[model samples]
Target: MALLITKRCINCDMCEPECPNQAISMGDEIYQIDADRCTECVGHYDTPTCQQVCPIDNTIIIDPQHIEAREALWEKFVVMHHPV
Candidate 1:
């Protein structure tokens, strides 16, 4: 599933550069994730780069309705301009 960024983001810009998909971006007040571009770091790394760099725990989670198979997620990211 795609990951979602909560309002707890501190706008530190820490997570943005860590995102392999370039899915995370600076929002008006917090960071936002573009689901279409997010791959949860499926292929590029062993874990989600954004989550690892996130200072706020639990800020990123699987989108219940957008559950995606790991392989499919990797494929999607591979097709995009993102790294994952």
Candidate 2:
């Protein structure tokens, strides 16, 4: 599933640079994750790099509205990083 950065984000600038998919960016108030580009780091790391790097607990959580299976996430990764 894609991840969501909650309002609890402190804008520490930890997650934005860690996302391999470049899905994380500065939003109006905090960092935001683009569901269309997010793959939970499926093809890049065992766990999402943004989640791992985020110091605030539970600041980054799965998007209930954009849930996706591992295979789907992988496909997104492939298409994003290895487009033909």
Best by TM-score: 2
Candidate 2 residues 1-84, lDDT tens each?
Answer: 899999999999999989988999999999999999999999889989998899999999999999999999999999999999
How many clashing residue pairs, candidate 1? Answer: 0
Tens-place lDDT digits, model 1, residues 33-59: 888888888878888888888788888
- TM for every model, in the order presented, reads 0.85, 0.98
Candidate 1 least-lDDT 10 residues: 75-84
Kindly report which residue stretches of model 2 are placed more than 4 angstroms away from their true locations once superposed: none
Predicted structure 2: lDDT:
0.95
For model 1, the stretches where C-alpha displacement exceeds 4 angstroms are 81-84
Q: Considering summed lDDT, which 10 consecutive residues are worst modelled in model 2?
A: 43-52
lDDT (CA) per prediction: 0.83, 0.95
| Clash counts for all predictions | 0, 0
User: What lDDT is reached at residue 68 by model 1?
Assistant: 84
